[model samples]
Target: MQSPLRHGRAALGTTIATGALAALSQAPERASRLFRHRFPTVAVTGMTGVGKTRLADRLSRRASAEGTQDVGSAVMERRTRRDPRMRGYRFRVVPGENAATRLGALDEVFHDEPVDGVLHVVAYGHATPRRTAGTSGAGAATREEQLAAELEDWSITAHRIAGMAVRRDRPTWLVIAVTKADLFADDIDAAVDYYSPGSGSPFADKLDELRALAGGAKLSIDVLPVCAQGGGRKSSMPEKAATELLNRLELRLAQLSGHV
Candidate 1:
């Protein structure tokens, strides 16, 4: 029979040997973790009532719900055959243009953790018709003039956000989402033509003004219409718009990941 002291010493030695083996086995995993990179964070910023929260929820594939003034967070994930696991980006839904909130949010983003992109949302319905010289005079404003004026007014917020992104030390890609597309689905093509460059229209001039505001920032900008409403409606317009936004987002992510 073994003495109790001898048995205790043998047990201690076995425990030490097992721990050493475990540590050796985990060394490669620790090294791999050190080299692993995390997906970029995308910050969503827009004026109040622009459906920023709704868009975040939709992008995360969640059911649409009421939006809050407070900042919201969500994760957007995609699975690839090579990884066989879902990879994702963090989405931070920031509050609207309150100076304090906006500044605080940017401060956190810049100092704590930098974001890869900005999903700057602009609401179309908020663009109220602008009073025109023609209306105050002998003539009526043309539909094109009215639309252009409204868009220009609504564009100020988007341009401000874009300019901020451009001025950041590491300029982030900008995705301008013209949300609430369902309201004008019937005239989507007209809106697109009006917003596109070289359309020889005043609205086109406004778009140019926005691009100029970026001012040599090496950042990519894309504008697309979006509808946060769930797909099940008579017009499948919402589904189409959401899909387009997702495709654009994927392209931006690829660029960030150096896969493009």
Candidate 2:
């Protein structure tokens, strides 16, 4: 018969040996984790209503659609596959205030994180029309003068935005969003008469202005007309623009991942 002390000692010895084997097996994993602690991220900066959130969601969905798997937190991701889902750049949605706040936020996020690229959106108009083309209560005779002021302001701001981007190290692709197409459409009749009276539509006039603004910025700006909300009895006309924006975003991601 074995003594109780001897039996207890043997049991304790077996437990210790098992723990040692477990620790030995996990040593490589710990080393691998240390290696994975270094990964790059993409910093996305845009205005509050410029569809940044929508783009991020679409990007995630598109990444998964490309048949990417095996994304480990502390494990090495083989960016070799150009998989946006698991690649060199991760996304950090930097929040911003109004237009100026947007630039500020971009600076702060880039300074503190790993940023490979930036997605910036610049759009037009606010809640109000700024000016209207009319008789102007007989006081302001020159309606054209009022319109000129509005356009000049837009042009000035547009240039300022572009300059700020240059200072911030602009991204591979800068998307210029043309928001509020529907609002312009509301003025379609008036606009068609004012700009394109012969036969062209109001949107035709809008596109020209958008193109002009984009050219001013010196960015290969892709115009996206989106209506997150809609007017009564009218469906949005720029639905195609939304698709184009999404497609462009995916292509940009692919390019960054080195897939394209």
Candidate 3:
């Protein structure tokens, strides 16, 4: 099925073209409530070297079903996007202790309210553990220890929120986002050339690296490939990918609630 965002957008364009704006205006919220009954929460998470922030930014706009502004490296602004379909439901994309506080704030904001769901964005700039001789290597004693550390971080976030507020019977999703696959892929290419010449190319080794870390997360996750840096520029395919993810999420809610 075509996404409501795309179809509705086309419908909206036709409505305006056919002078039906007056009709749509009378039923403004109708278009927004594509999945009104769902309290669906998605914790967009990944390692520190992944693209959490970018996914959050893109997904936020999809949640709101509106075009959002450009958010990239040149800027370090805190941002939020609220859903009109489910009023007071919003996604917070900022970092730090403020993120925890914002979660609680949203809980209070929607304390007595029904929700479509929650989307948690974790880790913006992160990478897989490189199998290096230095601090960034793969394995416990090598370079990528940071990646392991991040896995724990993501788990903590999951347990802290999903474990507490969500139910075991309910679907609590964790999107194990991998950012900078291009860079990682590139690095792999370089590595194969430098370290294991004639052994294998980096492209051949890319998925193996991704799989290793994701497996270590020990969490059932939707491993979404992402690239957040152009560092402060617009994403290539990620924005579209983000929209599709939101649609899947919407579908998940419907399946669970039988809203359809």
Instruction: List the global CA lDDT of all models.
Output: 0.58, 0.43, 0.40
lDDT of 3 by residue, 42-149 (tens): 333233333445555554553322322221222222344445544322343323222455445334322433232334332322343324335543433333454445
The prediction achieving the highest lDDT against the true structure is 1
On a 0 to 100 scale, what is the lDDT of residue 111 in model 3?
A: 42
Ranking by lDDT: 1, 2, 3
Backbone clashes in model 2, listed as residue pairs:
41-90
Candidate 2: residue 151 lDDT (0-100) = 48
Candidate 1's C-alpha runs over 4 A off are 1-37, 64-86, 97-99, 110-113, 126-171, 193-217, 231-233, 236-260
Q: Write the per-residue lDDT of candidate 1 for residues 176-225, one digit (tens) a residue.
A: 67766766777666655655556766656755665677653555666666
Which has the higher TM-score value, candidate number 2 or candidate number 3? 3
User: Which should have the higher lDDT, number 1 or number 3?
Assistant: 1
lDDT of 2: 0.43
TM-score of each: 0.55, 0.38, 0.39
lDDT of 1: 0.58
- Candidate 3: stretches off by over 4 Å: 1-41, 45-50, 62-89, 94-143, 165-169, 186-220, 229-260
Best by TM-score: 1
Query: Model 1: how far is 16 from its true place, Å?
Result: 27
